[model samples]
Target chain A: MTGSLIILQPGHSVVTDLGRTKGPAYGLPVNGALDQFSAKAANILAGNADNDPLLELTALDFRMRATTDLLIAVTGAPLDLTVGGRESPQWEPVSVRAGEVVAVRGIRTGLRAYIAVHGSFTVPSLLGSCAPDTVVGFGLKLVEGFRLETRTTTAPITQPHFGLPLFRLGITKPAFTTNPVIDVTDGPDVAEFGDTAGLLFTTQYAVSPRSNHIGLRLGGALPERQLTSEVLSRGVPVGAIEVPSRDELLVLHRGRGVTAGYPVLAVVTSRSLDLLAQARPGHTVTFRRTTVAEATATHRTACLELERLRQTINTVFGLLGIGAGQRWYELSPASGA
Target chain B: MAATTTTTSQTTLDIYESGDAALRVVARSGDAETNWATVHSLAGWLAATGVEGIHGAVPTYDSVLVEFDPYLTSARQVRAFVLLGMRQLDFVGTTLREPRRFEVPVVYGGDYGPDLDRVAEHQGLDVEDVIARHTAKTYVIRCLGAPAGSPMMDGPDFPVPVPRLKDPRLSVPAGAVSVAGRQAVIAPAVAPGGWCVIGQTPLTVLDAAREPLVPYVPGDELRFYRIPAEDFGNFAGQFLEARP
Candidate 1:
C-alpha cells in the first residue's frame, strides 16, 4: 500500500540569502545545508538509497502534511519539532498520523537540519539531481505556501534506531584552536604563483563573511604571483581554491561557475567538502597538503562506512520480522502481529 | 624519465592527475583547431569507454575535466582507463553542430553603453566604425556558465582589446553587452560587472521562468543589431508579457 504525502512549497523567502561581493569584486557563493551529514544518514536509516532526495531545512521554515503514515528520522542541526503546534523531541522517530502537520523550527547548534522521509520525496529532476542548485534556481526551494507532492506508501511507522557513525570511522571534528586544515593539489596556472606564495597557503586563514555556495573567501596574507596578467576563463568546480588577486583565496562550492580565469591554489578533498559547506561567516579554516594516495584512501573509507550504515539498518528491520512487503510493522518487540 | 608508450596506437597521450579524484589528458596540440579537436575526440572516446565512477566529462577549448567519485574508482585506475580510451579515438575533426542563432537587437551608446565613446577613442575608430566592427562579426559562443547563460564570445580581433574598469560598477543592467580583453559577453541577469559596456541587447538571455532557462548554448552564434532606446523598451515589454 502506497500513499501520497504533500509537503508545503516554500514561499518567496530564500533560506540562505546571497552574500556581498568583495575586492576584485568577486561574488561569494552562499553554500550551506541544514544537516549535511545527517541528511545523508537519514536516507540510509530509512532504507533508501544513499543519493535519495531529502528535505533540507535551515532554522525551521518548513512544514509537511502526512498523507500516509510513514517512518521518518530527523538528523543534523536540532530543530524544534511540532505536530499541529505541539512540541516534540529532536533526533528521534515519531509517529505522525495522516493529515497531521509536521512543523520544524531552527536550533542554535547548527543553521541547517535534515528530514528524511521513509520513501523518496516527489520532485522534478534538474541537471540529473533533485538537490536544489540554489544559485542556478534549478530545484525547488521550500518556502511558505509552496506545495510539494510525495509518493504515498502505507508503511507502518517502523523507526530503525541508528547512531552517529563518525566515531567508528576515526573521524573527529578539528579543534577550533587549530587552524582549519584543507588538503589541495596543484591546479592549472599553479606555476603562475611564486614559490613564496605557494608556501603562504600553508599558513592559517579565516573564512570571511563573503562566503557562499559559489565559493568561500579566505582571509589571509595575500600570496604573491609571478605573472600578474589575466588568465583566459575556464571551467571551475567545487573546492577549486582560486586566488583571483592578492590577499584572498576563493574556495569554490557546489554551485561554482563552470568556468573561471582565477589561479587556483588547491583543490579540497571530498571528505572536507561538507565541512566547508557548513562553515559560518568569519569561521577559521586552515589548509594542509595531503598525498594523492592518502586522499583516495580517505574517500574510499568514507564511502564504505556510508554503505555499511545502510546495511545495518536493513539488518535491524529484517530481524524484527519487518519485510519489505509488509504494509506496516510494529515498533515494539512482539511475537507475530 | 622514460616516455610511456601507448599499446593500441602510437598516438602519444600524456596523463597527469589533477587531484585524487580527477585526471587530465594532455594531447600534443598547440593550435586552437588541434586543441579543441583533441578535446572533443577525447571526450567522445571517454563517453564510449563506459569508465566506471566517472560522473561526467566537460570538454573545454584545450582540456577536458573528468568528474568522478574517488570512492568508486581510484585516480590511478581512471588515468589508465583514459589513456587506453584515448588510443581508440579515431582522430577526426568533426564540425560541431550549429546552435540556435539569435539576432540580438541593441541600443548602443548613451545610457545603455556609457563607455562607447571611450572604446571608440581608444581604438581611434569613429563611433560608427566601432559599432560596425562589433555588429558585423558573427561571434562564436565559447562558454555560457557564468551568471546563468552569459555567453563568452570571441570578439573580432580588434586592434586593441578594451580593459575592464579598475573598480567595477555596483550593478550592470540585464542584457548589457560589454567587452573586456578580447572577449564580448552579455549580462544575463542584472548584477555587478567589470566589463566595458558598449551596448544593450533587448533579448532576454536568461529567464529562469522560461522552458530552456538559458537562451544560448556553447557553439551558438550571436549577432547584435542596433535599435532605438524606445524600440528596445517596446520589445522587452512584449517579451516579458509573453511569459506565463
Candidate 2:
C-alpha cells in the first residue's frame, strides 16, 4: 500500500475528494466527486476515510498496475472490472497482489466510475481537497505513465473472501434509468420564470453532447423568460437549472463556477443531484417540482440510510479483524445531510 | 440610539430559497450603490455570527447567497436566523468598516492591451484620452466571482457603456484589465472572458498561500495608474497589495 499505482492507460481520470468546503467566499468553485454517494461508498469499502482522494474514471477503459498488496473498491457506474485478467466484483472490496494489473473497462451504464484504494492517493491538495478546478487552474490530471503514491505500508485485508460469516452490504447504485424523473425545488428566480417553469417538467430533455463536469446542457425545451431584464452576476449553487438567453437549458453541477448570470428556473434536490451525476449524453430526463421541506426530508432519509450502512460496516470489519476502516471512522465521523 | 432609529424604513429584505441547503437574500429600498454596500455588510455580519450549520456567505451586487448544511439546520431555521441577525446588525454604525484602498499598476495599449485601439475607436477618443478617463475615478469593488480573485468593480465614469466582445477570447491573460457596461475588472487568472481587455497588470492577484487569497475584499476602493511597458515585466510575480 505504500508503493505507487502506475497508470498504464489513463482514460479521463483525475483525483477527487470532498473538494473545497470553504472557498466559495473567494469565488472558488467546489469541484468534488459528482456522485457523492458512490465516492463515499467506494472509500468505505476500501478501508479509507469517506472523503479520501480517489481516482474518478469516465467512459473509456482504464488500466493501472499496483506495486504493493492493496485492497481497492470500484463503484459508481457498472463496468467490466478485472485483476490480472480475472473477473472481479465491483462495489465490493477486492484484494490485489503487488505487480497485478487491474482493468476497468466497458462502462455499460452511467457516466463515471470510482477507484478507491485502501491507503488513499497521495497528491497535492489545495483548499483541503485534491479535486481539480479547471477555472482556477490547479490539481493533478491523471496521464499515461503517471504514478500515484500511497501512504499506508500494510493492507487492511489480505483476502477478498473470509471464513467467518461473510457479509455484504447492498448499496443503492447511483445509476440513471432509461428516463429518470428527478425532483427539484424552486430556484431563486423561480418567480421571475412565470408560466415558463411548467415547460421544464412537461418536456423530456435529452442531455446534450456538450455536457461535462461544469454542467449538463439539455437540448429539448428551453424555458422562455418572462423577465427580459438582464440579471446581475450572482452566486450559483450546484444543481441549479439555469435558463440562458439562447441555446439549451443548463443544469449547473459541482464543477460550476461560484457565480453565473443566467436566471435559474429550479434547483435539483440533493439526492437527485447524485442521480444526475450518472446522466450521460443522449439520456432522456424529466424534472418534477417539489417543495424545499420535502426535498430536505428526502435527503435526510438518504443520509440516515448511509449512516446505518456505515455502522454495519464497522461491526463487520471489526469481526473480520480489519482495524484500518474503524480507525478512520473514529478519527473523522461522516458529515452530510 | 442612532443605529436603532436609522433602521426604520431604510431597507427591505427578501429571502429566496435556493434548493434545500442554500438561501438567497436580496436587499432593496436604497439606490443601486448603497444596496451593494448593504449586501457586503450583511454578508460579513452573517458569517461572523456563529449560527450553527451556516457554511459560507457569498456576496454579489445586491444579494447574498448563504450556503448551509441541510441536515444540521433547515432552511426555515436559517431564514429565521438571518432575519434576526439583520435586525441586530447596525447598518448605520460600526458594522460597516472603512473601505481599503489599493492602486493597481497597468500597462495600456500595444501588445499588453489587445483591444485598446478598438475601444478607443468605438468611443471616438484618442488612446491617451481613454487611459486618462479610465484612471480618473476611484472604483469600488462590488463583488468577486469566477476566475479566482477578479474583483467585479463599478466606477470610471465613462460617457457611455462599453459593450462586451461579440466573441469572447479563449484565454485572456492573467491580470488583464477589462471593462463592460461601465464596470471594470482585473483578471486574476487567465480565463475566458467577453469583456474587452484594454490593459494588463503584472501584479499577481491570487496566491493560495496568502490569507484571504486576494489583496482587496469586496467594498474596497481601487484606483488604476499607468505604468510603462518596461516596468510591467519588472513587477512580475509581485502581489497586488492594499495601500498600507
Q: What is the C-alpha lDDT of each candidate?
A: 0.61, 0.81
Q: Per-residue alpha-carbon lDDT of model 1 for B16-67, expressed as tens digits? A: 5556655555455446756565665666566566567775555555566666
Which candidate should be chosen as best, given TM-score against the real structure?
2
lDDT of 1 by residue, A290-326 (tens): 6668878876776676677666666565554433522
- For all candidates in order, state the fraction of native interface contacts they contain: 0.28, 0.67
lDDT of 2 by residue, B1-244 (tens): 0001123244777778889878888877567766676677778887787577887888898788888878889988988887776776644432567889999999998888999998888888888999999999898888888878579988466777888899988989888999887789998888889998999999998886665578788878899999999998899778988899
Which residues of candidate 2, in runs, are more than 4 Å off? A1-3, A153-167, A324-337, B1-10, B50-52, B91-94
What shift in Å separates residue A6 of candidate 1 from its native position after superposition?
8.1
The Cα error of candidate 2 at residue A45, in Å, is 1.9
lDDT of 2: 0.81
Tell me the deviation in Å of residue B178 in model 1. Answer: 2.0
